[model samples]
Every structure is written in C-alpha cells, then in structure tokens.
Target chain A: MNPSNNNIETQDDIGTTGHEWDGITELNYPCPRWWVWIFLGTIVWAVGYWYIYPAWPVISGDSERGGTKGVMEWTQYKQLEESQSEIFSRRAENLEKLQNTSTKDVMDMPELYEFAVVGGKSAFKENCAQCHGSGGGGAKGYPNLNDDDWLWGGSLKELSKTIKYGIRSDHKNTRNSVMPPLAAVMGKDSVTKVSRYVAGLSKGSSSTAEGAKEYKQMCSACHGVNGEGNRIFGAPKLSDGIWLYGKGDEQQIESQIKSPQHGVMPAWIDRLGEDTIKQLVVYVYSLGGGE
Target chain B: MLEKHKKLEKNSILLLIFIIITISIGGLIEIVPLFRLETTIEPVKGIRPYTPLELAGQDVYIREGCYGCHSQQIRALRDEVERYGHYSLAAESMYDHPFQWGSKRTGPDLARVGGKYSDSWHVQHMINPQEYVPESIMPSYSHMATSKASLDDIGSHLEALRVTGVPYTDSMIENAYTDAMAQANEGEANTKDGLLKRYGKNTIVRDFDGKAGFVSELDAIISYLQVLGTMADLKDYNPDVVE
Candidate 1:
C-alpha cells in the first residue's frame, strides 16, 4: 500500500514523507504506531475471528454460520446470557431475601433498596419499559414511577394496595373513582366556576368565594375542606403542583371540574404474585418516593 | 468515459447484490427465532418463569391481543408516581426471560395485576367483560376459565423453562405434579403446598387463597400479577445509580 516505502523521506512535521506536488505537498503520514497497531490489530483479530466464528459466508447458514460465533462458539446472545446469569445469580440472592423478609423491611433497609433498584430497573425495562419510556419517564396518560405524586397513594400499604388491586380494572378489589362532572350537577360554565372553587383552595384567590364556600362544604367531604386530598378515594391533592390532567389552567380545571378525569391502573394480583408485588413495591419505592 | 461508466456500473451492481445479501441475512435471523426460542433460566430465588399452560393462558391473553387495549409500562414522573404509588423498578421482571413491556393503553396498564381480584371475578369478567365494566369495550375470556384447558403439557412447559434456567425447585415441580392430579375444586392445597415448599415455610400471606382458593395455573398467574408497584418507599430515586 505504500509507494513511498522506497523513498523514506522526512517532512517538517514529526512523522511524514516530504513529497511535494506543485506548491501543495503530500505529507506521507504513516499512521501512528497506536493507530497502525489498532488497525492491524483489528485486521488480525478479524481474521482470527473469521476463522473461529461463523464469519465466513454461508448462503443459508443459521446462527452457527457466518455469524459472530467465536472459536469458543460464543455469540452475542450467549455472551448476553453469561452476563445475565451473573445478574440472575445476584437476583436470586435478592429474591431469596424478598421471600424471607417483609415488604416493610425491604423498604426500610438501604441495602435492600439498592438491590430493589437494580432488580427494578431490569424488571421495569422488561415489563414496564415500553409505555413508561426507558426509565418510567411516562407518556401522555401513563403516570411516572419516579415522582412523589401518587394517584392511589404513596404510602407502602397504599402503594401495595394500588399495585395489588389496581384502579377500576374488573378485579374485585380494584379502586374506583369518578369526577361525575359538575356539568352533571349544574352546567359547563358552572364547571369553570367549580374549577375556580377548586383553585381557591390552594391560595384563596378564586373568583367565586361562594363557590369556594361550596367547595369547603361539598368538595371537602372527599377533597378535604382545605382541598388537599383524600387518599382513600384517590382524590388528588388540589394544593399540589402535579396535576394529572394538566397544570392550573383555570379554564382546564374549570372544564375538568365540570367534567372530571378518570385514570385507571390495572390490578396485578391476578398476574404476578404477592412476593413479586412486594418486590415491585420495594423497586417502585426505591425509585424515589418511598419515604 | 464509456469504459469508465461500464466499470462504475459493474461495481455498483456488485455492491447492490452484497447489500441485498446482507439485508436478507439480517431479516432471516429475526424470522427464524420467531419459530424457535431458547430455553430460559428461571430466577434461582425459586420463582420459575411462566409454565406453558400458564404461558399459554398468557399467550391466549397476548394472542387475543390484550396488549392492543392495555399497556404494561408505568412511568416514573410525579403524578404517575403519586397515582400508581412509586415508579416501577427494573428488578421485578428479572426472570421474565422475555419481558413483557407492552405498549398502548386503550385500557389501563397491567404491570402489577397480581392478587388484585378474586378468581371468580376474573371468570365472570371473562364470560361477560361488559357485565363487570359498564363502559368496557374488551372481549370476553369466559370460555378460557370454563374450558377444560389442556394441562397435559404444563410439565413439559416447566421443563422447557427449566431448560432455559428458570429455577422451579423440587417443591414447585412437585406442586405442578400434585396439582395436576387433583380435581379442579381441590387444587388449592396443592397450590399452597407448592408455594410453601418453593418459597419456603416462612412466606407470609394472610389470604393466599382469597375467595376462590388457589388453582396452580391461577396461582402462577396471580404470583406473576400481585407484584406491580410494591417494592420500596423511595427516600430518593436517582437515575445515576444505575451505572
């Protein structure tokens, strides 16, 4: 490849052939030792790999042929499995601990939480990654697992209940909540009025004090007179910044109050298991909202 | 220019064939795997992956294309965390072998549906999905609960999963056998014995047989479901810790 090998000339630059063309010149820069080493290393490795693995062409070769099956017959899937086995073994230990220890204990212990987080990440990736994004970042309707805000409740028992029972799935224990629409009670404009009523609870600047008074009386029964929230009913805390439908768009809130929002989280008790649920709780709890 | 053009054309044709060959090979890899799956390892902590019967039920679920309407993933944002409790973690599905992070949400997400409902409700809902859900658009699976599902291959399914590496243990295997022999009504003892033996004697479950009692397949399904969000109450959930 080197025509210049014959003319071992030196350039002003550290490593190059001082070959000149017209006014411009070709500095025959032999690649760096590291560069050459890497290139040749790759070449040699490729050849070796080609021989050892299924790199050679086969018209209809299965995985064993023309693939990266090394001399040791190693493929990416096998490597992944090996690496995964290590993780699985580690998981076995954690699962063992989960079987013996209580979910509450798993929550309290930092080590268990750490274990829970690692397991949770893999499990989430496998089971919950699609809709939740890679790390439970959430989409339009889905809720995030990382935040402190909870729909059913954030406490261990509450979270467990939510996971086990789910929300509004046909499961017998499922939690059910509905806003019933202020429009149903009154009218759509009244929805805006009621939204203002709900808004008034946060800072007391709602346009309708009478509405707020009504809120303290009617809404307070479930939302708390202060408009905070009632966990039992899954009534979201009105004072909090995390709005499920949207932020405090007075119009939207008004519409929502007029109409209301109903979100559902399916019950899992019929799918996974109690221990798995507890592990999931620990995993979810470790996601940043447990305490 | 003509000679050069011919040479260029020749080279381009060669490149095109090579590219086509490469593309075909890549496509075939995916196609072939769809028919054959590797035996997966069950988590050594004693929880085996879903057995074929249970897996069949799940497949019945997947084929009925339940995922089209329901999503399985949960997010980790504030409201989601608040609503679903904590964000879903990664460890809950370590033994899934082929994890089921579903997409779409015409209905709700089912990442954690274990132990949430009584078995009879599941049966009733399957028979008449809309009876339980007044506004539901889901198809019914009542026949699945009522039919004499082929339980013969369940052992092979477990062994197949065992071949892959899911840890079923002696008792789990035993439970599978004993449960197989019992009348449908008497499956609870077998399920309990199996779970106790496999999970160990100390596992705490106040209502392991809530209402409908335990059927091994149902137990297996519920075991897979009951755990969704109950992991830990996070003091802090920093993503940086993952590396």
Candidate 2:
C-alpha cells in the first residue's frame, strides 16, 4: 500500500479525530494500555465493593430498615462494636479483677494496680485532663492530684467518693459547703482584716494578727479556730500555701473572703461508669497524693 | 465502536446529555438512600427541635463559625467512642436543619459537650479559653457576654425552620421572645414554668452567662452548648439490638 493512500483511507492506516486547530489535525489514538486496564479495574473494584457493602437504597416504612444489606452485612456501628469488644476482651480479665476488688484493696494487687493505673491514665486524659492538668499538676482553680493538698480528703476511699460524687456537683449526694460571703455578712473592712489574718496563718504569723478577733467570731466554725481546714465542709487547709482561686496573698484571700468562689467538678459516676471510676480512683491515688 | 462514536462526538448536545446521565447515576446512588431509607436516623426518645433561645444560639454558633474548628459529629471509632462517650447516634442530631456534623476538627468534638461542664465553666471557657486551658488556641468570645441576643425576629426564625419540617407550634412562635428571656432567667418566680411546660422538663433553663436580666449572646450560646448532647438519655439505647 502506498504511504499517502494508507494515511488517507486504507484500513491499515492510523486515523485523525476529524478536527483541526491552526491547520493541525488531532490524532485519535486509543488510551494507554495501563490506563485502560486501571480504569476497567476500578469499575470492577467498585462493583465488588457495592456487592460487599451497603450500596443501594430500598423503600421501607419500617424505621429500622436502612438499605439493601450487602453480603458482608457490615455497618459502622458494628465495626465500632467489634473493635471496642476486642479492646474490652483484652482488658476483661484485669477489669473484672479490679471490679471485684474494692477501691481500698486495689493497692494490694500489684498487677491489678498497674492495670488500673494504665487504664485510668488513658481515661483521665480523655475526660479529666482537659480540666485538671494532664500531669495532674492542676490549674489555678482545679486541685492538683499530685500534691498532698485536697479540698476533700486524699484517701483512696475519699478519692473514689469525690470522683464519683463531685464537690458541688449536680449529683444529689455531692459534697456541699458554702462560706457565706463575709463581705456581705460582716463589713468590708472586717472581711479585709479576716483575709489578712487567714493569709498570715499560712505564713506562720503570730496568732495575734490584726484580724484575730474577727476570725474567732465569724470564720472559726468551718475553718477551725487555728485556720486548719475542716474536711467535713470540704474547706481548704488554711495552714498550707495551696489556694484554689489564686495565690494565697492578702488580695487573693480578701477576694475569696469577700465573694467565695466554690469550684465545681462534674460527677463522673454517670459519665464514667463504676468500673472506670474505680480504675480512675486507683490512677489518681498513684499520682502521689493518696492519703 | 469507533465509527459509531464519531456521530455522537460530532454532536455537542449528545455529549452533554451523556455526561449528565453519567453524573446523575452517581448522584442518585449516593443521595437517594438518605431520603428513601427509614433507618437513616435511629428512633430515640427526647430528640426535640431546639427551643427558641437554643435556636437563636445555634444561629450565633453558625454566625461565629464555631463549626470551623469544632465538629459536632463523633465517628463510630474505638478512640472516638472512648473519648467522646457513646458513639454519636444518627438520632442525636436528626433535628439539626443543616446538621453541624463538621468534617474538620481543629478543636475536640462538641457532640456530647453538654452537661460535661457547669454553666459557669462554659461561661469562663467562652470568655477566655486560654485562662482555663493554658495551651488552648481558641479565641475569646467575651464580646458575646456584652452583646444582647437578638430576640425580636426569633419568631420569624422559628417560622422559617417550621417550613423546613421542624415541628414548631404556633404558640411557640408567638412566645419565642418571652421563652428566650425565660430560659436565661430560670429560677425567677414564674418565668421558667411556661418554658418547662412548652419544652421538655429536662430542658435546663438557667442563667447561663451568669447574667439574669436580659438574654445576652453569651447566654444564648451557653444555653445552646449546655443542651448539646443532654437531650437523649443513652441508657435507653442499646446498639447491639437494632430497633
């Protein structure tokens, strides 16, 4: 066959797409072999995917009817349940042991203690770490778990109770205390004097401070006669330097005395279930502050 | 096949028609299921439409672009379930008009942030997030505290949402402004009783922004935040059994 003839009309000839731009004809070459194979492969894969997974919508009056259940009969919730069950199964033995063991007895079982600590640390990071620091060092108002100071007691049983029924939480059994605004009850001047007296207590000042008289008259009941905190009232130990609102300076003390700000922690029993709370109590105890 | 294709390729309208048909096949498959299927949303109790104040707050949430950083949907994954609590149910946000199931998560999921913190904590966090959370990148919304919530057109908003299938009663629309005010000043003598009567008893009516007189934008937002996932009592829901 002649080259010119083949180019124009012969069966052996390559063809143009019958279009021209600036006197150049477009070639109508087939797609690349790999590209065509991949394109076809994707279509086949998609068909397989649709067959194995939910793909089509079916009309059904029943609210439970989602769609056409593929051969795999898989769902996101089922996948989550399976994955979560795997995790639970892995921890089941330890969790059951911890569940059986009382909060006080958890300390005695070293293996269970280690499990609780690890589990509790993870749970705390997910929940409590946002408010209380990740290291349990505590923010200004948030109580530090690592320190000996606790608004409530620091024993394992106390920690568990506090964690379950939070201080000033909405829980019916939540620990409650109210230091009536001293500035409102007594004069502002008296509040200032009392604040100075309380501030001086942590500094080891002489008991005969300027506001010593006011302290005995107004604040002695809940905050003991010597500024020692009363656990019953969840009051801060005044002898120590730890302050919930701010640094225990005169101004901070004065501000707190004038308008007492009660820190609120959410009750975790409903949120974190009993088993998890048990683990958390142990974890917090291991943080070096358990009494 | 090559010879037959030349006739169709030569015609622009035919090519366009074929393209439309190709695209519609994918679109119909993806979208039709959502409407046709009955179980797209699980049937759970207590999933009600937002109260007027909460609705106003939702508008504020959208206006301020809270969805830019915070996603309301928690995926059904092990970590997400463990962290955010029970994997988010479809029914949890079924009443959401343009659901705030955001794709991006610059901040943590706000799916079950309701009842997680106290009203005061929410107020403080909103005012200055960095003060409480030292490493937070969230900006302060202190301006919302001072800015009064716009309640004048709240009825119209309810009406608009009503047209889009939300079951807003005529009385609810009429009492929209009062209800917004009532929600913010909960404990005052007779204000909240009507609100509680209208919305469910579980509706938490409180001084969300710590200001009682007028409904501030902060109050609206906080009220909205406080009600996020507190609605559906999850104990009644069991995932293992499909209902």
Candidate 3:
C-alpha cells in the first residue's frame, strides 16, 4: 500500500500498518515515549518491591517456609512495638511518676492528677464505660460515679479498694455481700411490709409501716436503725433514695426484698495493673461523687 | 515481526492459549501461596480447639450474626493494639470453620474481650445491651435467656467440626451433650473432672447465664464470649518466630 493512494488523512499524518479488515486499516500509533518508559520502569520496580517485601513462598525440604523474610525484615509486630515504644518514651516521665505515687497522693500533685485523669479517661472508656456510663452517670442497675450515693463508700482509699478488688467479683479479696431472699425466711407479708417501711424512709415520710420491727431485727444488722447503709456490708443507704435496681417504688422495693439482684464487677488488678488502677481512682475521685 | 503477529492474531485458539497463560501468571501468584498455608500461619502456643459449650455458643453467635457488628480480628495498627489488646494471630482462629475476622465494626473488636467483664455483666449486656451501654446500637437478645440450648444435636455438631480438622476425639463427640450440660451446671461434681480432662483445666466452668434448670442459649453465647481471646497467654508469644 502506498501513502499517496489513501483518501483519508490523520491529524498527525502517521502512516497505517499494512493490515486491513474490510475497509478499515490498522493505524501505527506509537505509544508516547514517556509512557513506554514508565511501563518498563514499573516491571523493574515490581521485582525490587518483591525483593524488599515478603513476597514469595520458599520450600525447604519437606516444610514450606512462608516467604523470603525481606531485606528490611519488617514484621507487623515489630512495627507495632516501634510505635508503642514511641508512645512509651513520650509518657515515660508520667508513667514513672504514676508508678511511684500512691493513688491517694496522686490527687495532691497537680501534674500527677492531670496525667492520671488523662490516662484514666482513656482506660475507663476502654474498660469501664460499657457498664458505667461514658460520663460516669450510672445506669439502671449500675451505680452512678457522679453522685455521693456510694454503695461501698467513696473515699479515695475505699474507691481504690473497690476498683482494684471489685464488688462481688471472683477476686479472692472481693468485697462480697449477699442480701438473702427474705420472702422465704420471713413471710411474704412481712417482706412487703418491710419494703413499704424502707420505701417510706427514702420518701422522708416517717410512716410506721408494720415492717419496722422486722427491719430492725433482719435488715438493721447491715442497714442502720435509721436505714443508713453500712460500708462494711456494702448496703445502700435507703434514706438517700438513690436506687441501684429499679425506681424505689413500693412494687420495686417489694421485688428487691423478695429476691435481691447482686451485681458483679470483675477484678481489674489482674487486667489493668496497680498504676492504671491508681490512675482510675484519681479519675473517679475527680468525678464529683468521690468522697 | 509485524506479519508474524498478524498470523498469531488470526488464529483464535492460539490467542486464547496465550491469554490463558498471561492470566494464569497473575492467578498463580495470588493462589499458590494459599496452598502453603502451613508456612504462612505462624506457630503459636496455647491455641486450643473450642470446648463443646463454646462451640455451641459460637453457633449461636453465627446464628445471631454477631459478627455483623463485632469484629474478632484486631489489626496490626498501634491504635487497634492499644484498644483491643494484642493484634490477632492466625493460630487463634485456626479452629474456626469459617473465621469471624469480620471487616465491618458496628461494635468494638471482641478479640480480647475475654475475662474483661464478669459473667453477670455479660448476662445483663446480652439481655439488653442498651441498659449497660446506652450508646450501643446492639439489639437485645433477651429471648435467648428463655430459650433452651439444643443438646440433642451437639454431638453431631462436634462430629461435623471434627471432619473439618477440629480434632474432636470420638469420646469427646460421645460426651458432647453431657459436656455441654456439665459446662453450664458447674455445681455438679461428677461431670466436672471429665470436662476438665477433655478440654484443658483452664476451661471456665460456671452457670454463665445465672440460670440452672436447662442450659439456655444465653449460657452458650456467654461461654463463647468469655473465652474469645483468652486462649493464648501473649506474654510468652514471640512474634519474631514466623513458624
């Protein structure tokens, strides 16, 4: 085929190849010089990439060793360790301070308190926020950390002990208590009467509900004569009206009297170490409800 | 060379063969490594098969589509490691017939939720997630508390898992029903030793759902959740060894 014999002309005037089907001709469009170079460059780059990274599996005798461990020998765990070490180095001063100071003493040091609060906030979100509200607002069954109504005392030492060992937890030294179902031992009528009297105490109405005698005999061992809760037994202050289960209505009170629900908090000492627990104590104490 | 190419293009069979060969290079690169999975998975100690109760609970987990919200695999990123304990290991889910290393995280990663909360917390959380976690979008599984776990098919389930390399022994399969019951009724003394003998001593035995008459679906699921990433003691884990 001759160039002069063509009726159509391309913009670049590039010649067509001698291949044709029907009336159409195959144009000899050369790829851009830069693109052709880049195409070949990527092939070379791929070989280098494979060499630098764990790319191909290697079979040695009967076993298959995962891959060539790369020239950089980069493992994800190593990267994680590197990043974590960076964080650790940055917080080394605070971490040391946190370790040295007791949880109670952490409050006195402004710098330490700030460090602990920050650390404890993140730790609480990870661990405690699920049960205890994100802002320390207690849920229906869970106790509120923002109020002075503490079931097992709210002093820094008390809070620290509770946080460390946990209430009704599996920990060997867990603050354990059980309010046995009174309906079985005492008659159901007596339980209802006692519940009504207890409910009346929180309402500020000194009603002589018939269960006052039963309350003194059975419940007063843990709950005081005036319904003040005992920290030793972890009994709630009935007079304060801060209910842990349901609203302290007559029915709710009666249900609790029948079969009390015991809440369990896992021991955090095994999980969050003493330093973290100390930090948590400072953070909790700072939450306004701390005694 | 141009004329030779024209001849090659004209022959469809030859073109097809070349296309196959070209595609196979990419295909082989992606697939052949999977055949050597033994090498790819690092050897880690203390990764054991799920006990009968745990396996049953895992079935409940699958049935409920818990993986839709919760991811079991924690990535190798720093933030994820700090939040969800150690990054997940392949050996951890080796026994998982269909692994639950989910992609979407509607809920937090459950890779290391084991022993994080008490059994009672799990019971409450499962009954009503919003009651414990007000911000949680998780649905209530309160019905599970009432429904009894199916003990009849437990042995057959173990046998099926055995077919997929779970290493459930014949005796384990035989006592699967009893073992599931024993796990839920921890107070029963006779079945305790047998369960311990079968599934290591570290196996947690308790009335997980705080109910006793029959093993509830709640018990199975709680048992599964309680043992999620507690298998391996990561302190002894050496990530340097790729074996």
Candidate 4:
C-alpha cells in the first residue's frame, strides 16, 4: 500500500488529506483560532517579561556583566530592599520606642510591650524555635524560655544582655563560663558522689555522708554551698529540678558532671539590631517566668 | 509550509539531523556559559574552602540526604532576610562541589544555621529532631552519635576536592585525617594547633558529640552544620553594590 493512502476524504465534504483506517478518515482540522491567538499572546508576554527583567547572556561586551539588565533594573535584591523599606516605615514608631526606652520602661508601657511581644514572638520562631521549641519549652541541651529557671538571671536586664551577647558565643561580651569536666580532676568516684549529692538536692533525698563531703570540696565554689547556684558564674541551681543539659536522673547527672555540655547561643546584636534585641528581651520576659 | 513539513517528516535521516541540531543549540546555550563561571560568580571576601572535618560532615549531610528537606539557599526576599539573616550569595556556595541549594524546604533553610544553636543542641537535634522542636517532622539520626567517622579516606577526599578547585593544599591533604581528629578533640594540642594553622584561628576545636575520647559522625555533622553560612563576612557586604 502507498504510505499516503491513509489520507482520505470525509462525508461532510470536509476533505481530509487522502487518509483512511478501517472505514474511518482522520480530520486535518485547522488549529483553533483562540488557541493560536493565546500562544501568540504568550510569546508577546514572554518578550515583554524579558525586556522588564534580567534575561539573555552577554555575547561580546565586557560591559554586559552576565545578563541583560532590564529597563526597570529590577532584581530580587532590589525587591527585597523595597519590601524591607516598607516594613521599616511601618515599624518606625515601634522601633523608635524600642531603641529609646529602657528594658524596665518597655514593660511599663502597655502598647510598646504588646508591640515588642508580637514582634519578638515571630522573631523567636524564626531564630530560636529550631532548638528551643516553638513555645520556648526547649530540648535537652537548650534552655527553656518559659521557666523561671535561668542559668543566667531571669531579670529583663539579664535576658537583654544574654540575647545581645549570647552565652559562650563569639561575641566579645558573650556570657562566658565553663563547667569544667570534674571526672578527670575529681576522679570517677568523687565525680559520681558529687553527681549523686547534686541530684539529691532537688529531690530532698538524704545525701550519703561521703557524697556531701565531696560536693562541698568539688562543686560548692560555683554551684553554691546550699546548691542554690550563682548567676554571676552562669551556674544552674542544683536544688532546682530543672536541668539545662539533661533530666535530673542519676545517669543524666553523672554524664553531665563527667563531660559537661556547654551551650553556645549566637549573639543577636550582630544579626538582629539593638531595637529587635530589646523587643526580644521584652518578649522573653513576657513568657511568664521573668523576674 | 505544509508541503515542506511533509517532505522533512518523510526523510528520517534529515529529521534526525534537524533534531540533533535543535537539541545542540539548547545544549550549547546552557553549557557554554560555564566556561566563564569565574566571571559569573561575584568575588566576595571571607569565603574560604571547607576544613577537612567540615568536608567530612558535608559528606555525611549528603549521605543522609539533609538537602532533601533543608535548603542552603536563602533567596533575596524580605521575610527570608529578616528570618535567616542575610540573603545567600552565590560566592557563599562557590566551593560547594554539588551545591546544596535545595528547592523543597520541609524544614527551615539551613544556609545560616551555623553558629545559631549550640553544639549540644545540634547533637540532640540530630539524634532526635522532635525532642527539641516538638512540631518538627524530621527523622531521628541517633546512630550517628555512636558510629565512628572513618578518617582513612579523608586525605583522598581532600585531594579529590583539590582537583575540583577547592584550593586544598598539599600540607592540608597530608594532615587531613589528623586534622579531622584534632578538630573534634581539643586535647590533641599539637594536632589542634596544626588544624588551626592550616584552616584558620576561627576553627572551633572541641568534642562536638558531647562524648569524649571518640570522634563520632555526630561530631563531623555538627561541625559542618555549625559553619554553614558563617564563612561569609556579611557585615561588609553591600547588597546595593553589585560586583
């Protein structure tokens, strides 16, 4: 059979190109007029989009940096800058208040406090919510924000300082402290005894006479005589049930004493500006545990 | 036009040739510009090659398909800039062999995740992501904490990266294994000092996995995560001044 024999004519006098298959003819219909028009319209739109946005690589000239910069000079960076400007304008008043007012004054002013809390909540979700929970409940190593138990003081001033400089961060003014690994210095037996004594403080369990002696000699300097902890040294109170690194169990306490995990919080002063940091301070304070 | 199309369609060889030419045009347009990649990437300060340990961690990250969920690219958007610090620059990922500019963000963008959380936080988060972020849908990688990272192939890995334009020196390649060990254990004074000298003064030398006496996969991963977007000096970066 001829290759073109399948091209056949139809009954309606709408001639097909002499093609047929099993008593049927294929209709060689013209492309839909609307569809063709829309296709052409899309091409036009694309050309317009290219003209208005960075498109096409440079072929010859050094002046053509990489791509053809559109007539409007629109870029993702420029778009971001414009949006940031708009946001800045909107928050100008609140930002100004945050910058000027003291940490105490921020809490006193209801409107400013509300503004800070709202802004800080979103900021915390973005910055601190990964390790510290969305609600600031905190994980094993991370400090819970909602509790009164603060390794550093819970006061607004202390929180502001902590947020600005961070704990053991690279920041110059970072709240630096190291709970030295006592297992090496105190020996395994003494470290275990101290761990037991520290754990028993919170539970009100009677510490072994040997453990009590070891606790006074090895742990008391920074952890305090009564195990109340010293905020100046960034030590957690042993008497408090709250443990930053682990749960207050025998194994957990022993592991912590043996090889202490020092938490490092990145400084927000460099990342988030002073105004935002102040707002964060107020927000953290409003988490219902601040002094 | 219909007659010309019919003629071309009838000749298989001619159609094949035309198809090859059409495909080549697209291929040339895409591949040719890569030759001028140096000019295309903006020159930026503080963008250094990854250390041996960080490189090992990056390998582990890829192995675990961390990029499947976490994006290394922070797009120049107001919200992204506000949340994830500065928008990610092309130069920031210049040394990345297979870039981690992921499309899907099941988790947050990890471009600026370095130094954001503590080492212990990272360790705990990796061991169990939900333990920290209650709402996080991320899977646990607790095995990494116990598993010992193989340092035997690190020197070769460095050499391979060097061949692919990572600027890993002969000295760096030679000391790659020792440097990986040193970076994880601060007690190794000689090797730790050597690591700092080779990499930089800013190289964080400590037991990353919280467990002493062993350098686990957890240490490498933590080291890698801790230095994600911290390499680039964004303080001096002027977004308005396009290089």
Best candidate per lDDT, number? Answer: 3
lDDT of each: 0.57, 0.84, 0.86, 0.84
Count: clashes, candidate 2:
0
Candidate 4, residues A163-182, lDDT tens digits: the string is 99998888899999998888
Q: Candidate order by DockQ, highest to lowest? A: 3, 2, 4, 1
Each model's DockQ score: 0.02, 0.58, 0.61, 0.58
Model 1 spans with C-alpha error above 4 angstroms: A1-90, A108-110, A129-133, A137-139, A203-210, B1-243
Q: Local error of candidate 1 at A220, Å?
A: 2.2
Model 3 clash pairs are: B43-B243
Query: How do the predictions measure up, each by TM-score?
Result: 0.40, 0.88, 0.87, 0.86
Candidate 1 falls in which docking quality class?
incorrect
Question: lDDT tens string, model 2, B115-200?
Answer: 78777777878888986678889999989999989888999999999998788898888888888888888434686788888898
lDDT (10s digit) by residue, model 2, range A1-291: 666653442453668877755666665778999999999999999999889998767776564456777999998888988999999999999888887888788899899999999989999987887778789988767888898887889998888888898878778989888888878788988988888888889888786478989988998888888888889898788877787777899898888877787778888899899999988998998999889
Ranking by TM-score: 2, 3, 4, 1
Model 2 complex DockQ against the native: 0.58
Root-mean-square deviation per candidate: 18.1, 3.9, 3.9, 4.0
Q: How badly does each model clash, as a count of residue pairs?
A: 82, 0, 1, 6
Q: Which stretches of candidate 4 lie over 4 Å from their true place?
A: A1-29, A60-64, A183-200, A203-213, A245-256, B1-27, B36-39, B186-189
Off by over 4 Å in 2: A1-12, A16-27, A207-209, B1-34, B186-188, B240-243
Judge candidate 3 against the unseen true structure and give its global Cα lDDT, from 0 to 1: 0.86
| Residue-level lDDT tens digits of model 1 in A1-291 | 466644334324453433344544455656679988898889888888787775533333233323244477754445445655775686787778877887787767788767766656665554454434566655434567689777677777887888788776656788997767666666555556667776665555645575665566457778887777887788878876666666666776776666565655657664455766776777777777765
